[model samples]
Target chain A: MSSLAAPLPATATTAASPASHEDRSSFAFLAIASLFFVISGIVALLVAGKLQMPTLLGNIAWLTYGRMRPLHVNGMLFGWLLAADMGLAFYLVPRLCGVKLWSEKLGMATMYLWVVIILGAVVEIPLGHNQGLEYAELPTWLDVLVVVAWLMFAANIFMTVANRKYEQMYVSLWYIMGAIIWTAFVYLVGNFATLFTTGVNQANLNWFYVHNAVGLIFTPLGLALGYYFIPKAAEAPLYSHRLSMIGFWSLAFVYVWTGAHHMLHGPISQWLQTVSILFSVMLMIPVWTLVYNFFATMKGQWHQLKDNVPIKFMMTGTIFYLLTCFQGPMHSLRSVNAIVSKTDWIVGHAHMAVLGAFSFFAVGGAYYAIPRMLKTRLHSQALANASFWLWLVGGLSFFVSLWIGGFLQGLQWNDPSIPFIDTVKFMKPFWSVRLIGGTFMFGGILLFFWNLLATWLHRSERPAETV
Target chain B: MIKKIDKNNILFVAAATGFFAIGGILTTFAPPLLDASWAKPAPGLQNYPELAKGGDAHADLVMKGRAIYVRDGCWYCHTQQTRTIEADTVRSGWRDVRSPVSTPDEFVFDKPHLFGTRRVGPDLSRAGGKYDKQWHATHFKDPRSLVPGSAMPPFPWIANNPAELDAMVAYIQSLGRAKDWRPTHDYEE
Candidate 1:
C-alpha cells in the first residue's frame, strides 16, 4: 500500500489522522540550505560589483572577475534557486497529498547531496574545472550525483502519492510530478550529450538543455506553487479544472519545441528555427490560461493580499510570469532575436522569469508552509512587506538597467563607427546602476532570512489566525 | 453526482511521461532523422589547422584557454558565433570588423560548444587577426589603461601568469577558425 505500484482504493479523504504527522526534518534542512546558498549568492554579486569597478580586485586568481562570474551564476542557479525549490517541495507536497513522506531519510539525503554537489561546483568551477557550458558548468562527476539525487526524490514522491488518503488529486500534484519526470530527462541528456556530440550538434544539445531545464523544471513547478497557494489563500476552489487540463497538456506539447528559439539566426537549420518560433508563439496559450485562472480565482479575495504575504507574492509572481512569457515569444522572433541575441536584454529577460517570478513563488511557498510546519505565526508582516518591496524595486530596476544598456550596446555594436571599447564605456553607468540594484536585492534576501530565523527560534508573538 | 477520479493513478503519470517524451523526441531527435549529417559533424572535421601546423600545437594552450574561459565565465559576455543574419554578417561594425556569417559546419569539432548566450562584448568569431599579442597582454593586465571607459576587468592574476595569459589569447585567437577549414579541404559532397 505504500509503494508506487500500490492499487488505488476508491475512498474519500476521511483518513487524515494517519497522514497528519508529516516529517518536518527534511523541511527544516532544505530551508536552512536555501538561506545559506542565497547568502553565498549575495557575496558573489558583491564581488561582481567590485569587478565592474575601475580598479578591479588585483591578481587574486580565485577571486578574479572571470571566476567570480561563474560562482555568482552557479551560486544563484543551483545553490539558491534549486535549494529553495526543493525545500518548498519537501514541505508542501506532503501536506497537499494528505500523507507523511514515504521516506524522510531519502528526502534529507537528497537535500544534503544537492548541497554537497553545489558546494563542489562553487569551488571547482571557479578553479577552472567547468564544462565550459552555461547552466551545465558543473563537472561530469557532479552531474552524475545530481542524477542520482533526483531519482531518489522522484521515488519518494511516487511512493507518498501511492499511499495518499485522497481520491481527487490536485492540479499542483500533476504539475510537480510531471516536472520531475521532464527535468530528469532534460538534465541528464543536457549534461551527458556533450560527451557524444561535436560542433553544431553539441551546440543544439546545450540550448535544448538550458531552455527546457527552465521551461520544464522551473516553469511547471513554479506554476504548481502558484496553483496551490493562490487558491488556498483566496479560500476558493479553482475556477475551472477544464482550464488546468488545457494549460498542462498544451505546455507539455509545445515547450520542448520552443528551445531552438535560443538558437535563432545561429547555424541551426532554417526549419528548426521556424518550428521553434511557431511553438514559442503558441506558448502564449498556457501562459494566458494560467494567468486567467489565477486572476479569476482571486475574484473577491483581492483584499486578502493586504495582510496575506503569500497571496501578495503569488499575485506579483503570476504577473511577472505573464511578462516573462510575453517577452520570451516576442524576443524569440528572428527579427527581434537578431537584435537582442547577445545583449544584456537577454540577461534581463532571464532574471524576470527566474528571479522575479519563480523566486517569488518559492519565497511565498516557504512563508506559507514554514510557519505551518513550526506551528507559529510569521515573525512580522511589516518586515515581510519590506522584503517584498525591496525585491520588487530591486528586481525591476535591475531588469530596466540591463535592458536599456543591452539595447544601446546592440545598436552601437552594429554601427561600426563606434569602437567596441567606447561601447563598453557607455555601459559603465548601467553596470554601476546594476550594482546598486543587486545590493537592494541582497538586502531583501537578508531580511527574509532574519524573519524566518527569528520565527523559527522565538515563538514570541501571539499566534494569529493561521495564514 | 460527480465521478471520483483516481487521483493517484499511475496511468496518469504514464500519460504525462509519454507526452513529455514525444515532445522532446520531436524537437531533438526528429531533426537528425531528416538530415543525417546533423547527428554527427562531417568525418575528420578540422579545427584550427593553422594552430595544429605550428607543431607546438599540443592543443595544450587552446585547451587551457578554453578551461580558463569557462572558469572566468568569459562566454557570458563574448560570443564566438557570427550568426547568419545581416546584423552579424554584413555590418557587424563592432571593432570595425566585417566578418563572414558562421556556417553550421564550423562548429563540428566543438566538444562543448561555446555559442555564448549573451553578448556584452563584441563577437569574437574573427578575433584571431584583429589584435596583436601585445595588445592582449597589455589589455588583460589593465583594460582601462589601454582603452579608457571599457567595462572589462583587468585580469592581473592571469597577466601575472604568462603561460595562462598565452593560453587564453591562443584560444581567443582560434575562434572562428572553423570557417578557415573550408577553403583548403575536400568535402564528400
Candidate 2:
C-alpha cells in the first residue's frame, strides 16, 4: 500500500507539468460536489414521495413540493453535476495543455466561491426567493455571485489554454473552450436580460437559458470529459477526427435554436416553433456523429468494459447519451410534443440526460481522475462496481416508470371524459415506483460518497501536508 | 481546415462564437423583439387593473397575489399558458366553459412570465371564476378535501391570514376574465 506514495509519472505529453495545488483543487471540487450529489439524492427521494402523497411532510412551507422540486433540480444541476464537471475540467485542462493550471490560488478561490453560491441556493430557493425562471431560479444576488464565480473559472481555463506548452489542441480542449464561452454568453443573457424583459419575451429568453444551460454548458463539458476518459480508459486513440469536427460544429450551431421547442404548441410564434423543431431534428446529426466517434474509438476495446470501471461508465453514458438525444429530438415533433410536453415523460427524458448520461460521465471522470489526483487506487473497486449497478438499474426503473406513467397521464388528460383529479390519481402508482427507484439511486450515491471518502482517507497514501 | 483552426486559439474561439450566435440570434434574440404580440395588450387584460368594485384595492390584491404566487413557486406546478390543444381546452375550462387558446398578448403584464413547464396539478390559465373564493380558500388549506387524489401541496398557512387568502383568491379569479367574460360561478361554503 505504501507504493501508492510514489509520485505518479508525469502524464503530460510535453515537459510542462501541473502545479502541486492543482491536485488539491480538483479533489476539493469533486468532494464537495459529491456531497451535494448525496444531499440532492435525498431531496429527490423526498420530493418523489411527496408527489405520490402530498401530505407526507405535514404542510411545512419549506418542504412543500414547489420549493423542494427546484432544490432537487438545481442541486443536481448546479450543486452536483456542474460542480463535478468543473472539478473534472480542472483535472483535464492542465494535462491536455501540457502546463500547470494558470493560477492555483484562483482555482481554489473559485472552488470555494462555487460552494458559497450553491449554499446560497440551498438556503434561498426553498425560502421562496427565486427568479421564477425554470432553471435560473437562484435569487438575484446569488445570480450575480454565480456570474462572478463563473467568470473567475473561465478566466483560469482560458489563461491555462493561452499558456499551453503544446501548440496543437485536443478535441477535449475545443469542447472545454466552447463550454466556457457559451456558458458565459448564455448565463448573462438568461439571468440578466430576462430581468429587463417581461411577458412572452421573458418566457422565450428563459427557455433559451434553460436549454442552453444544459446544451452548451453541461453537454460540452460532459463531452469533453467523456472524450478524454473514454480514449484513455480504452487505451485506444479517438476513431475519426472528421466525425469530431462534424459533431462539435453541428452541435454548437443547432443546440441554440432548439430551446423554443420547450414552448411548442404554447404561445410562442409559429415560425419560431417551426425553426426550433427543424433545428432540433438537425440535432440528430451531431448526436449520431459523436456516438459513432465514441463507439468506433472503442473498437477492439470491448473487453475493457469487464475490468476497467471508467470505460464501463463512459460506454454506458455514451449509449444513454444517444438515447437522450434521440428522445429529445423526437419529443420536439408537434404530434409528440402535444402528448408529452408537460407530463412526467419530459421529467423522465430530463433525468436520462443529466443523470443517466452526464452524471455517468462525471462519475466515470471522478473514478478516473480522483485516484490519479490522490496518487492511489480506489479503496474498494467492489463498492464502485456495486454502485454502478445500483445507478444503472435504479436509473432505468425511474426513467421507464415515469415514461409510462407520463404517457398514460397525457392520454388521460386529452380525453375530456376523465377529470383532472383522476389523472393525478392515475399517476400515484408510477410515483410510488419512482420513489422506490429514487431510494436505490440515493443508496447508490451514498455508496459512491463512501467509496470516494475511503479512497481519500485510505491509510496507505495521503497528499503531502506541507506544500 | 480542422487542424488550422484547432491550432490557432483565436480562430477556434471565433468559430465557436459565430456558430452559437447564428442560432441564438435567430431563435431567442430576434423573435420577441420582432413579434407584435409581445407589446400588444390582450382583451382579457383590458380591465385587469380596474375591477368592477374597489378598483385600486382590487388591483393591489392581484399584484400582491402575484408576488405570493411567485414566492411559493406556485408556477412550478400550475402553468399559466393554455395551449391551443384539445387537452388544455377541455381540462382547464373557464367557469365550466372552454376558454380561447392563450395568446402572447395575454402575458404582456407578466414580468418573468409564469408559463410554467409542468402540470403537477392543473393548468391555472382559466382558473378565474371556475370556483368561488371559498372553494379556493378551502382548496389551499387542503387540496385533497375538495379534489381527492390531488398531489398539490397544501398551503395551510394561507388560511390563517385572511389578507393573503383574499389576495390569492382575487388573483386566481382575475385569470382569463376578458372584457366580455364575467364571474358567474358561486360555490357553497
Candidate 3:
C-alpha cells in the first residue's frame, strides 16, 4: 500500500496548495457531516428493523416508528448529505476558480449555522413541533435559521467566484455557482417565508422546495463534482466541454419546472400538472447529455476502474445517476406513478439518486481530494476499496428491493376488494428485504466513516507530515 | 483543436428545442388530454339529484375532513384525484373494476381535487365507502395496529382530542361525496 504514497506529486506541498486553509474547514465540516450520516444511518436501520419488531424497541414516544422515520430522513439528507456536499463545494469551488476561498471565516460560520439548524431539528421534530411536510418538517423557526445559513453560504461562494484568479471559469465552477445561488432562491420561495402567513400554502411550497432540493441543489452539486473529478482523476480533460455546457444549461432550465411531477395526479392546477409532466419528460435531454459526457470521458480510461478507489465510487455513481433520472421521468409518467408514487419505490429511487449517485461522488471527491490536500498518504486503500464495494452492493440491493416492494404495495392497495390492512400483510416479506438492504447500506456507511476517520486522525498524528 | 459549432451539435440543440416547442404547442392546443381521471368530477357532483339537496351535514363533514387532511399533511403522500385510464389508472384506483372511476368533468366544480399521486399511504379517493369511520379513526390514531407494517405515521394527537377525532372522521367520510349520492348500505351505520 506504500506504493500509493510514492505516486503523490513531489510539488504537492501540505500548505502550499492555495486551498489548504479551505481544506481544513472543509474537512472539519465533512467529519461532522460523516458523524451525522453514521448516526442517521444507524437510526434508519434501527427504525426499519423495529417496524417489523415494534415490541423490541419498547415504544418510547420519540423513538416510535412514526417520528423516528422522518427524523432519520431529515437527518440523513440535511445533516449528512447536504453538509458533506457543502464541504466539497467549499474546497473544490475555490480551487476550480483558481483562487482561495473568499472567506474561510464565513465558511466556518456557515458550518456552525448548519449545525445549529440541524440541532434545532433534533429537538423540535421529536418534540412534535414539526410542520409535518416531508423534508420541510423542521419547525418554522428552524426554517428561518436554515434560510439564513444558506444565504450566508451563497454570499461567500458567489463573492469567491467573482474574485477568481483565473479568467476562464471551468464548467464545475458554473455548476457549483448555480447550485448555491439557485438553492438560496428556491429555498426562500418554496418556504414562502414572505408570502405565507399561517402556513396555508404549505403543500404548494413544500412540494416546490423538497423536489427542487433534490433536483436542483443536490443534483447540480453531484454533477459538478462528477464533471470535475472524473476527468481530473483519470488524468484527462473533459470529453466535450460543449456537451457539458449543454447539460448544465438544460438541467438548470428544466429541473425547476420538473418538481411538480412529484405531484403528478395531484389536486394542483391542470396547467401546472401538465407543465410539470412535460418538463419531467423533457428532463431526459439533460440527463442523457450528462450520461453521455461521463461515459465518453471514461472510454479510454476504463482501466482506472480497476486501480483507482475514487473512480470506482464515481463511475458507479454516474451509472446510478442515469438509472435514477431515467426512472424518475418514467415514474413521473402518470401510469408508472399510479402504482409507485408513495411506495418504497420512490424511497428506493431517492436513495438511488441521492445516496447512490450523489453520496458516492461526494465520498469519492472527498477521498480523492483529502490525501492530496493533507499532503499525506491515505491510511488504507484497501478500506477505501472495501467501502466502495460495500456501498455499491448495498445501494443496488436497496434500489431493487424497494422498487419491487413499492410496486407490489401499490398493486395491492389499488385492489379495492383487498382490505387496506391486508396490503400491509402482503408487504411483510418485502419489508424484511428492505431491512436487510438498509442493514447492508448502514454497514457500508460504517466502513466509510472508519476509513475517513482513520485517515484524518492518522494525518494529525504525524509529527512532520510531508508532501 | 478547438472547433466552432458543428452541424452535429447544432442538430442536437435544434432537435431538443423542437421537442420542447412541440410539447408547448400540443399542451396549448389540447389541454384536456393532460387531465387525470382522479381530478375529474364525479357523476353525482356533476348531475345533482333532488335527494342530494338536503345533505348539508355531509358537506360540513367533508369541509371538516379537508381541514384535517391539510393539517396532517396527508396530501403529501395520498393524492385525492385519479387520472384517465391510460395514465396508470390501475395503480391509482381509477381503473379498478370494483371502484367508481372518476371522470374529468366530475372535478369541474371541485375547488381542488385531493387526488394526489404519491401513496406514502393508500389512495383516500374511495376511502369513504371502503372503511368504517371507527376503522379510519383507529388507523389515523395508530396506523400500525390496523396495518402491521405501514409507513403511514400515526396521527394519535388528532384522535386523542374527541373534537378533532370527530372532525377528522366527519371529514374523511365526506371525502367522495356527490350532490345526489346516498351512503352505501354498509356505511349507513
Candidate 4:
C-alpha cells in the first residue's frame, strides 16, 4: 500500500528541483505551522464547547469569549491558513520554475516574522490592543509585521520567478504571484486606510479590508494549491487552460467590489450597496466557470480519490468552494440580506468558506508538499484516511447545524412577537451540536498533525533528534 | 498568448494591482465624497433638545464606561446598530414607547465605529436606561445569572474591579441617547 509515493511530475522543466535543500527547508516551516493550526484549532473548539457551560478560565482577562474569539479567528487565518499557504509556496514555486528558492534563509526569516506577528496578535487582541476591525484586528504596531513579511516573501519569490530556468509559467505560478501581490495591497491598504477616513468612510475601508482578506488572500492562493495538486495527483491535464485564465481575471475583477455587501442595510449609501450586490451577483459566472473547470479536470479520475489522500482533500475543498460561492452571491441579494445581516447566518457562511472550503485546500496542499519535501510517502495512510473522514463529517455537521440555527435566529429576529432571549434559548440545542461538530473537527486537525509528525520521523536523517 | 505574460510576472503583478487600485477608488475612496451623510452629526446639546433644547453632552462617567466597553470587547457579542426597519424600531421601546430607527449621525462621534459585526446577544443601540447599574453589574458578572440560556461568558472576575464595572455600565447607558433625540422618533431606553 505504501507504493503510494507517486513519482515526481514528468513535466520537470526546472533546473533546480523541488527536493533541493532550499525548498526542502520549508518542511520545517510547514510542520511548525500545521502544529500551530491543530493547537489553535483545539483552543477555538474548546471555546465553542464552553459557550453554554461555565467559562474555561472564569474570565481571567484573556480567556473570556471576547479574547478567545479573535484568538480563534486570527489563529485560523494566520496561524493555519496563511502560514501553510506560504509553506506550500516555498515548495511549489521553487519546483514550478525549476529554480532554487531565491533564499531559504529569507524564507525562514519570513516564517519567523509571520509567526511572531500572529503570536503578537494572539496576545494583543485579547489584551485590548485591537484595531476593532473584523478579521483585521491587529493593532497598527503589530500590523507592520505583515507588511515586512510580505515584502520579504515578495522579494524572494519575484526573484525566483525572475531567475526561472523555464520559459512558460504554469497556472500555479500565475495564481501564487497574483495572490502574493494582491494580498499585500489589500492588507496594507485595508489596515491603514482607516487612519485617514472617518465614520462610514472608515467603515467602507474596514469592510473592504475584511472581505478582500478572504477573497484576494485566501481564494487566489487556495486556487493556486488546487491547480498544482489536482493535475499532479490525478496525472491529468487541466480541462482547458483558456478557461483557467478566464476564471483568474474575472475573479480578480469581481472580488474587490463585493466587500461592501457586508455593510448593506446599515449606514452605507444605497449606491455603494447596489454596486456591492450587483458585482457579487456577477461573481456567479466566474464561480461556476472555475467549479466546472475543476470537476471537468477530474473526469475519468474520480476513483483515484479513494486511494489518494491529497486528491480527497482537494476534491472536498472544491465542493465546499462551490457551495461557498453559491451561498455568497445568493445571500448578497437585498431580500436575503435583510433577514441574514447581523444574524448567525453570516457566521455559518463564514465557516462554509473559511473553515470548510479554503482551509480544506490548505490541508490538501500541505499533505502534498510534505511527502515531496521529505522524500517519503506519508508515514501512515490509515491516519490520513481517518483525518479525512473526521474532517468531512465534522465540517458538514458544523455547517448544517450553524446554518439551521442561524436561519432560525434570523427568522425570530425578524418576528417581533418572539422575545429575543427565546431565540437565544432555542439556539442552545444547535449550539450543542456545533460544539460536538467542532470537537470532531478539532480531533481531525490533531490527527493530521500526528501524521505529519510521523512523516518527519520516518526520515532516516536525525534532523529531529539533533535539533 | 498566456505564455508571454507568464514569462514576465512583473507585468501580471502590475495588472492585478491596477485592477484593485481602480476598485479601491470606485468602492472605497469615492463613495464617501459622493455621500456626505457618513459624517453628519446629530443636532446640538444632549438633554433631549427636541423637548427642551438645552441638553448637555453625554456624561463623563459614560465616556469612561465606553472605554471599558471597548476594553472588554463587548462589541464582539453585542451590536450597536439598529437598522431603519420596523422590527428594530418597535422592539426597542424598552422603557416607554417604541424606539426610533438608528440614524447615521448617532455614530458620527465614534472613532472606530462600534457597529458590531454580530449579534450573539441583542443589539445595544438603545441599551441605555433599560437597566440600571445593578443590572449591568450583575449581568456582566454572570450573564446566565440573568438569563439561563445566554452564550455569554461570565466575567465576575473582571467585573469585580469597581472601575471596570462602573465604566462598563455607564458606557452601555449612553447608547441611543443624543442631545436632540425626539422621544417618539428616537430610542428612549
Candidate 1 structure quality by residue, lDDT tens digits, B72-127: 77777778777876557544322433567766666666767778877666677656
* Among all candidates shown, the one with the greatest TM-score: 2
Q: Which has the higher DockQ value, candidate number 1 or candidate number 2? A: 2
lDDT of 3 by residue, A1-467 (tens): 12222222334354554434436557667777888989899888877776576544524456655567667888988999888888888878888767788887777778878888888888876665545455766766887898888888877777877777776667787677677766776676555442341111234455667787898789988888999889988887888988987887787677776655766665545566777788888899989999999999999899999979989888999999999999988888877876787677887898898889999999898888777565566778898888887787777777898888889887776565666556666666777877887787888788888877777567645423543
Range of the 10 consecutive residues with the lowest summed lDDT in candidate 1 chain B: B180-189
**For model 2, what TM-score is found for chain B?**
0.86
Index of the highest-lDDT prediction: 2
**Scoring each candidate complex against the real one, what DockQ results?**
0.54, 0.77, 0.13, 0.56
Worst 10 residues of 3 chain A by lDDT: A1-10
Off by over 4 Å in 3: A1-21, A54-58, A193-205, A411-419, A461-466, B1-117, B125-171, B177-180, B183-189
What would you estimate as the lDDT of candidate 1? Answer: 0.75
lDDT of each: 0.75, 0.85, 0.69, 0.78
Cα error of candidate 2 at position B127, Å: 0.5
Candidate 3 reference-contact recovery: 0.11
Q: Rank the candidates by DockQ, best first.
A: 2, 4, 1, 3
**TM-score of every model versus the real structure:** 0.90, 0.94, 0.80, 0.92
Please report the TM-score between candidate 4 and the true structure: 0.92
Encode model 2's per-residue lDDT on B25-136: one tens digit a residue: 8776788778888768876474443342355777888877877898888998888878989868767665456667788888887866989999988898877766888788
Top of the candidates by DockQ: 2
State the lDDT of candidate 4 residue by residue for B109-179, as single tens digits.
66567788888888888777677777777887888888877878888854798976776776776677753
Docking class of 1: medium
